[model samples]
Target chain A: MSLAPSERPGTHPDDSNLSATYALVLVVEVIVILGLYWIGRQFG
Target chain B: MQWIDWAIVAVYLFWIVWTGLRMGRKTEELESYFLANRSLPWWAVGLSVMATQLSAITLVGTTGQGYNAGLSFIQFYFGLPLAMIILSLTVVPLFRRANIYTAYEYLERRFDSKTRLFTSLLFLLSRAMATGVVIAAPSVILSVIFGWNLTLTILAFGIPTIFYTMKGGVQAVTWADVKQMVVIVGGLSAAAVALIMGLPDDVTVGAALRTAGAVGKMQALDFTFDTSTTYTFWSGLIGGLFLSMSYFGCDQSQVQRYLTAKSVDEARGSLLMSAFWKIPLQVLVLMVGVLMFVFFLFNQGPILFKNTYLPAVQSSTRAAEYAGLDREYAQAFENRKLAARAMAAAQADGAPAGAASFARSEFVRNDTAVREVRAKATALVKDVTGDPDYNDTNYVFPTFVTEHLPVGLVGLIIAAIFAAAMSTIAAELSSLATSSVIDIYRRHLKPEADDAHYVTVSKWATLFWGLFACFVATFAAEMGSLIEAVNVLGSYFYGSILGVFILALGVKRANGDGAFVGLIAGMSAVWWVDQHTATVYLWLNVVGAVVVTVVGTIVSLLTGGATAGPDAGKSAATRAA
Candidate 1:
């Protein structure tokens, strides 16, 4: 059987978008964590 | 435990069984059974992955770790995100593209059958034994709390899981895991909230945290560069990264989680989800433990958390000694609580010299008492159980749940613990069955078998492994601290397996012979280091991976390359004949 389309050897079709999305998620995660830390410090 | 608790647990079991039975129709074919037809969404796959890793032991034992040892353990997951990002870029895509049922199947194509077989066998040995321990951990806790036989407890958890897994396969495993994750997370959150409410009125969340911080429980980051220390920031970042990579990248249990993703991007996303959430999740679990520690400060808790061991001590000749030690422990805790309160008050009102000195003296005395009781408990356990290494770490959360949690919530928390255990057990059994059927049985014994035949065999394999895990669980009591047992087992083989995978991808010249020899050598070296060196076990993953790659590459260079092609040709010819 042939391999799945997304598993093919060429560059991923959504590589750029995926990377950008992932980067954004990472940034947002960090910001949220920092925000929580700040909040903990203030109210804590 | 009340009727409501039993009802909740009963309902949970019924729902799980029903979910499994529902997936039976979809599991008629091998592909559907093993890979869910590679048609899962990223979110489901992601949750399954997390559920598989965050077992019941983690919920109970990790919180206990936080309560006892502090937050330094959180550093152990520091490298997880990096490992996930790296794997997403590398092995994940390759495995998806190859459309291989097992990771070892790719090894045969890239190197030789022998290399594939060796690595797969190593995986089976480790995962099977580890799965048994996973089953045992929750079983022991349940048995202790409910006064059931441990062996019966093991079967109680193991049997239903086997039936569901055998009936529904990957589809059942994944969806069941989703429900299990919900129970686990919900239960933990509920427990945390209940704990906070149960605390004395003066013990606000902030005050609890401050107390925990004063006792070093809140020290999440330790920048010390000690290779010998297991949970330092540097060790965690470097060693933890290697361990996570080996676990997620090479271990079939985790690989199977991502393999079911709908696309390469989805698989990467699923892994990234784990990477992002693991540390924070661990932090939350540890925080629960820290809260529990603070709760104890305000309340009188058992001098020895292991009540089972306590009774054993009372029955022993050292009963008086134990009783005396218990009194000392009580006094010490009282003093410590006073010190902790003083420290909290001091910190609140700007630390005064007198308050600081009082807190310091109390802290020292309380710590001494804690150690003294622990020593007595350890000695008593050795006398009773005939094992000196028996530690009370695993008992910490279970004791809290049984003693403190309200009736209905206790049942939910217990169900949650079962969810954790079953989730990990299901994933491990599924992967074990997949590796056995795909890598060995299907490829060698019956290459021309239809999907139905393969499906039947897969179900049987799942059942077989489940039984094997149950049997192993019987002996798991001898193993100390379920968390440490799992990690030690992983370290024994993970590095070498990861090394072989690296060799497969990076060094084209590394033929099967080289890979095979290098793998053995890598494992041997890891064993040697474990025996002779003082390095933390987690770092062994790094050492093993590096050694396997370096040694495999060298062996490949020494032996002329391309032996794998001829080897596969011979195997094909033998099959044809």
Candidate 2:
């Protein structure tokens, strides 16, 4: 029997939102780096 | 420092210690002392996470990096947000669910006791030494600004921290960290505002940044794939990722922060908070450095940012030569100032990027001349002082704060520096004590000790590490740039430790034997790579982690891997491994 993701955390078998959150973080990082690159190109 | 400034600093110091002592009253038991009985709020834990990682070096050393090298250093943390996200998914939940005091405890349960002892011992060594560098960063730099003796300053920073952390425990340290984190952000915000305000009347913020861009201070990203380059998009994204994983996932100092949260989700929540804010916060920090560069472009910045060496140079035989360089520096400063103003004017007049190219090149050229003059003066100081390794990078921000900011603000920024140093020292001290008592003292020295006895041992452990860190600080002050000094020290050990955790969690056929041998191999490989190649320090983390996983796996397969016990290889994510 697997422990419920809410009460007991384990392998990310139940929560797809957690993956979304991780993906969101990566997306945000990409955007931030792109923004920084733009700043360099604009002025640097 | 003005009387009001001193008053503000004095009040801040006294208030923090008093608050820490009061909150630490409930830490009578081992769990409560070390983990606050796992009852802390996510926001508070989140703030504590930031407080521990963002040290005095962030203020004193990173700002100098911004001023000296520009935004290139920002790439070093490019992997941080992702690392936090990955950790929230893995260790934040794993360590919390496992109900472990130290991350190493899980290693023993998953692998063997030897792996647990060895990993924890490595943490104790790495963190204790890194803590000393953290303590050294602010005290040595601030001593010059405050004109206080280095030893006294080290004490002033270390003792209050040691006293409260010893008595109040992690609970006290965490609560104090929340308040200190606020002061740090507030001070940085204030410094940012004052820096913009200090720009010359003719130079707008946009104009100033454009001028900064001309000299490459505004460039925040480099696409270079060179392994020799320290901070690049690739190095930061890949190399920094491994380093961050090792630090937050495997290192006890960070694991302990999230473990204080009420549940697994809350622990992940705390790390997510860092994920969202860490990069933007770093941007603000580097911008402050860049703005200081712009601020100095028009204003008359000293030839030497450090005032401490002035006396020695004045008394030496090269004093006359130093005076001549000083005169040349003034002219170079004027040339650079005029070029900066012209660049700003061109931007204000709506010149296109292509049209303003000449002005930018002129500014860059003049800036180089200014650097040459300053370098000559610095050599004179080094020659006369007989301190061949003298560096003024850490002094740049502190000296600027004292020399430039309004009176009360100076005190606030200094207090922020104090906050940065004390918060880190408190966390490390508290974590050091936890690892010592939980892993070594109780586990080995006296396996049957009660809570009260262990708590007493923990306090003495905190005291011992505190004084040891203070002693290390005196010598660590001159190793190099305080920021890089701490990170380089960590990079040497962080990757290998992370590799061990990977073996236990991800590699199913890996046993304690594999983990142990893999750890030694990883560390030795990191050392070998560092000695043999110019592959930059960030990439060393990658080398260490990869080498360990590969070596551990081969050994584990050869030894027929441990597949017997119910708890064997039972990691949080792969519980049946």
A1-44: candidate 2 lDDT, tens digit per residue: 12223223346543335777777878888888898988888767
Second chain TM-score per prediction?
0.94, 0.95
Q: Which sections of candidate 1 miss by over 4 Å?
A: A1-10, A13-17, A21-44, B349-368, B380-385, B478-487, B562-577
True contacts kept of each: 0.08, 0.44
Tens-digit per-residue lDDT, B157-198, candidate 2: 999999999999999999999999999999999999999999
Cα lDDT computed for each candidate against the true fold: 0.80, 0.85
Task: Give model 1's DockQ, 2 decimals.
Answer: 0.19
Error of 2 at B201 (Å): 1.5
> Candidate 1 residues B311-429, lDDT tens each?
66678888887788778778877877777676566655566658755764566567667667767767766777676666667777888888888889988998999899888999999
lDDT of 1 at B562: 44
Candidate 2 shows a clash count of 0
| Model 2 spans with C-alpha error above 4 angstroms | A1-16, B350-355, B478-489, B563-577
